[model samples]
Target: MTFSEKLRELMTARGLGLRELARLAPCDSGYLAHMREGRRIPSAKLAERLDQVLDAGGELAALVPARRARRKTPKGKAGASIARRDVLALAGAAGLPRGLSGPVAPELADYFRDQLAGHYTADRHLGPFRLIPTAAAQYDLLCDLANAARGTLRPRLWSLAAGYAAFLGWLYQDGGNIDRSVYWHDVMLERAHRSNDRQLVAFALHNKAMLHADLLDGQGVLELTRAALQEESALVPKVRVLALQQTAHGISLTEDGDARDECDCLLDQAAALVDQIDDAYPWGGACLTPHYIDIQRATCLVRLGKAADALTLWERIMPSLRAAGARRDAGVFLARQAQAYAVHHEPEHAVTVAGEVVELANATGSERMRRELSALRTRMRPWAKEPPGRQLQELLSSMGGHT
Candidate 1:
């Protein structure tokens, strides 16, 4: 059922009215009513309050989709024929390079749309680096389109081009191509700057900083995060909260006394704004929770040599981590798990987890994960005399069964 329908059904079951629920929720009745009717989406804050009022389970009250009748598709042989033709047309025209006439040749635009759809479909078919050519072609097309546009079309084309660049950057990052990711990120940033779009610029800067954070660059992380937070007036409150989170991540890595203190204060402010903040979750991942904060806090504890405290926090958060689909991408998440385990002197568990990660990395042929696994093995090399460590080293060299 949709959130609205669920809300209505739950209220009726309890013999409660909208006004009563609103009073208990301590939010505006009109807003609650609108939410019930699907006229509006409740902010996280509002949803939390309503969930409390309803004595509901978790934050999933809004996750249910209202039931709707599925539309019937044509099912005759002729329908299949038409579908085949449409697919062929889409495939034939998608991803063509643009011409010099300024506007992306219509064929080129068609090509871009096709490539985007293809990129998402049957992802295993294409390798990560293939996106480089696809993205480069689209970028050229967008530039031509921008140059060709006059008056109204000009701004629209520019926006499309900028958005396309941002998408390319996202693809590169997800594909584990950091160098290419930054290149496109820079392109997107420049486009956003040229377009005078503060929000877009904020997005670009935040994403760029995120890439650096992923690489564990302390100074780079701090610098870019500061740049993100510096535009206080220009950023929405939610964006500001994210900048704070990024700053916190950087501080966790640095182990600086003053910076750690500042991050603690910043996190305190972030926690207060939690309910008030709009959606600023990165990558739509479940890590966008208080649990994620706890995980980072745990990491900080580990860096501070408070292994006992860190271990407690890790144990607490592991369930959430498991629930967050960490097992699905066993290559990376398992490696991270191994890292956590290794640092805590649980070499046996780390070795076991590393084995699983290496197997997945080999299966996926992900050099990125393989590299990470290698690094972890090197760290555990000191324990080479131990059977588990020795086994881990051998596992690292040839992740696949060939060795």
Candidate 2:
């Protein structure tokens, strides 16, 4: 039977409606409907998810056609040579294998881990556009390697693939491609489960929560972070710390009367945990610092409409942020600081900070920064004719009329 027919039969047998299946699959109902009607083919990743959700085992996944191979490059030519070069340099080898038919090297996983670390550092300074192509190519390479790998190497490669997928999701989110971001995060969660790594699983869920937080979906963030924290006692200190701070940010966005107080309590918990963390795992350790917790607390304060309080935190953190060389992050923080200035009725200061944000947004191609500036522009509409407001308007207008 066709995949859709089989899907429909399975759903009927289980008394599952379209929306119910979508929820269980954790995807959009409309996308599920299209798949049910055979208007679209499920990607291998989605097919795997649907199979598990419907308890079809391998039967459903079997229907997904293999992805078409990319067009062949010229002989002795490598596409995305920079990433390949980096891999070779890090691996200290002449070249990686072109295909997975040969026995994969056990140390290849280590090479990928190192490569991802470099990518993380680059992403801080270079943003997504310059890095995504190479990153995506490397992720595809990891997936191919994992598929043909066996024994102990298989899970390691899968874990690395999950990490790359999560990084791609974050990059897409920063670049404002929400749909692609969510898709990659789902891919990350699936691979994380396959790796049988509980810490990775928790990290995947928490990372997805970060995406929701960016979208200002307070309840969505809360739900995902809570799920991440379900096994908090077993998680590493860093994971717990990250989840706590994210949970605090979510609470601040909520309508709860005690949101600010709850947020503060959560931040305190996270900060205390930060002291227990070591540098063994560098994946998120950089963000588990006390200063990072303070940044998150500042974000929560802004969400809670305590603009002046948020500005105070921003002032203390701004110098350290610049010193850290995280240009994209600094830009995002500056945008928030600008918003606080506007809310505090410091229009001139707001405009000045916003102008800096606009430059960073253009330089970094950061949609998140642009979105922040857009919101600031809306808030400053009352002062549109004023010199400071007019300057802000012109700045946004220069960004393709995003105002």
Candidate 3:
């Protein structure tokens, strides 16, 4: 049977309807319906998800066609010139060299690292939409440099490339481009393994967990974070702390009766690890801060339906967040606060907070904030006809509505 035929048979065998299968695959039901009608082909990632959801083993994934090949460059010198030109194009966008010649200098890797640091700072204020092009270019340039380097320099270049890849992954995720986010994250994991850097490996795993967290895939977050902590002794304090906090986030997303308590335990462990981080470990970004752990704790409290407790934590952290001038992060915190108000039966307060979120989301063009606003809009549906709920809905609609 063909792929659609096989899909239909599997669904029938399992007594799974379109919406139910879509929920299990965590995809759009309309997309599943299109696939069933043979009007659409699933991407490789979606195919894999479908296989896992339907317990079809690898059969569904195997049905996905191979990606089209790029056009071939001419052999010898011509091909080399073409490749060099492409790399130079990426370099130009990344604010690097205009042209390539011989071996990639070791100093270039250091330059990339410094540039990445600047990009991180820029991302906090500017958000992902404005930064994605530059970040993607930088990642591409690093990939070219890593491929050209040799000996000890090679591994260092690969490690740097992995860092850039991870940043690009985060950018795409924040921009709401899930497919590109997954692609860049997978690239990061590959480059991390290529560098043979255990710490980088753990960091990559942690990043993937963050991606899952964005999707609210609790099990996925828990699994990846657990994998990240398997060699906890080998991780830097910062990475370990990040993994711990992420694990707590995963617990909060689950339906366990003791999720709040479990999350607190994880956060407490993370809090202890935070004190051990005396140096600026490069990987965790703003998450390296002492307040970050508490932010995660508050986020978990919100997820666990302890809105009042979350509101208390938000009140404590909002001053520091404002002082830090992390515009994108501030928007996220505000959105969460809005969620807390909605959950606590304070619709007017939720609308007021959501209005602030709309401004920040516009300023930074942060899809992350939009996503939070979307969830808030959904939560406020019970009061939809009321003025506060209608105001919140209108604010969200102004920001492009629910995703």
- Best-performing candidate as measured by TM-score: 2
Ranked by TM-score from best down, the candidates are: 2, 3, 1
The lowest-lDDT stretch of 10 consecutive residues in candidate 2 is 66-75
Relative to the true structure, candidate 2 reaches a TM of 0.77
Off by over 4 Å in 3: 1-101, 278-281, 401-403
Give candidate 1 misplaced runs (Cα > 4 Å).
1-140, 149-160, 170-177, 258-260, 267-306, 317-330, 365-368, 400-403
- How high is each candidate's TM-score? 0.59, 0.77, 0.75
Global lDDT scores for all candidate models: 0.60, 0.80, 0.79
Best by lDDT: 2
TM-score of 1: 0.59
Steric clash pairs (candidate 3) = none
Better of 1 and 2 by lDDT: 2
In the predicted model 1, the residue pairs found to clash are 1-65, 1-66, 2-65, 2-66, 94-111, 95-111, 102-144
Comparing 1 with 2 on TM-score, the higher-scoring candidate is: 2
Q: Among all windows of ten consecutive residues in candidate 1, which has the lowest summed lDDT?
A: 64-73
